[model samples]
Target chain A: EAGVAQSPRYKIIEKRQSVAFWCNPISGHATLYWYQQILGQGPKLLIQFQNNGVVDDSQLPKDRFSAERLKGVDSTLKIQPAKLEDSAVYLCASSSRQSSSGNTIYFGEGSWLTVV
Target chain B: QKEVEQDPGPLSVPEGAIVSLNCTYSNSAFQYFMWYRQYSRKGPELLMYTYSSGNKEDGRFTAQVDKSSKYISLFIRDSQPSDSATYLCAMRVQGGSEKLVFGKGMKLTVNP
Candidate 1:
């Protein structure tokens, strides 16, 4: 089985510019997530999708960030008017099941963004 | 205080030695614990998951959770050079949408 896949492993953008990252999760996985990891920090949950519907996005910066999981297989996370603090690694992950227990989450290689 | 606290160590150790990594959290509602290993420029891969405070072992890795103290630990036995990576501890509260709360990862380097 293939692992989660992400596009454009590295991205460089200037402040106030818009950027987007794409993710293709493992087949049969029902839970997909997008996380932002700043340098020297852990990945922070930006959004989560259960199939084609939203699960949780409470921590997302809605004023500048948005994400969607179209057709339940692939996802895209976008940030408009990016801030300098938005320069971080964007990570995508997926899990085969949705229970509060069991299933392991698999992650992609991440898309690193550098906003100048 | 941050929800999670971990020493971001560039922890260096000789090969074949045992390694211990740990993290603490402030939330008492968190019921599920997890440990992830991340390589350079890569997303983290789940290494262990434990619930309720106990010990679980797989191969050369062991994970321990102590809910009473709000602390967790990961131990690597017979560490190898390939074991070098950043380790992150994450937790989630019991129900609802279980988005993980993670700690700043600890970087480990196993020397040859």
Candidate 2:
């Protein structure tokens, strides 16, 4: 019954500094995702993990961003040398296997980051 | 062109009024359509999900998908102040790769 859980609801760092966000998905959920939502914009997927394995990360900026789900239950997204453009909300979401009803992804409160 | 396009509106309307929001997608491969509502500083929550086409109604919210026109719409009736939030339209292809392409989100304010 518990939804996805995230930590450090808010964060602020200077440009070029590093920041990380953690997420613990719903119990028994097998798929996890990390998304970045800039102010006034929709959420943009950064990466996806399917039980410890990456499913997609094509949109992720490898030069500065990285994420991992080691055990498949929890995930962490990191950004190094953060830029002002990187200021956004990091949202973690999870979902069960695809079914006839379709995959319904549930999101956490998100970790807000502001790079000064 | 972007795969999905939605007007970013900070629309304000009186309470109890009917509201309509829409999005257009360029990808014909997208088989699943969804609507998510997000409040300030919060994550997005799923509001509606539809497969393929046609219309699906839930309470005061209705979602319609027109694949031929590559357009999708969400209609809210008797809106309340609580319904004020940013609405996003998302879509994805069926089967492998659960990547969802999202719109720019439309912000709505219902004044009582």
- Score each candidate by Cα lDDT: 0.92, 0.95
lDDT by residue for model 2 (B1-112), tens = 9999999998999999999999999999999999999998789999999999999999999999999999999999999999999999999998888988999999999999
The reply for model 2, stretches above 4 Å from the true place, is A98-100
In candidate 2 the C-alpha lDDT for residue B44 amounts to: 93
> Residues A20-93, candidate 2, lDDT per residue (tens digit)?
99999999999999999999888899999999999999999999999999887999999998999999999999
Residue A67 accuracy (lDDT) in model 2: 95
True contacts kept of 2: 0.77
RMSD of each: 1.5, 0.9
Model 1: residues >4 Å from true position, as ranges? A98-101
Q: iRMS of candidate 1, one decimal?
A: 1.4
Query: What local lDDT score does residue B39 receive in model 2, on the 0 to 100 scale?
Result: 90
Predicted chain B of candidate 1, TM-score versus the true chain B: 0.98
For candidate 1, the lDDT comes to 0.92
Model 2, residue A106: displacement in angstroms? 0.4
Roughly what TM-score does model 1 have, to 2 decimal places? Answer: 0.95
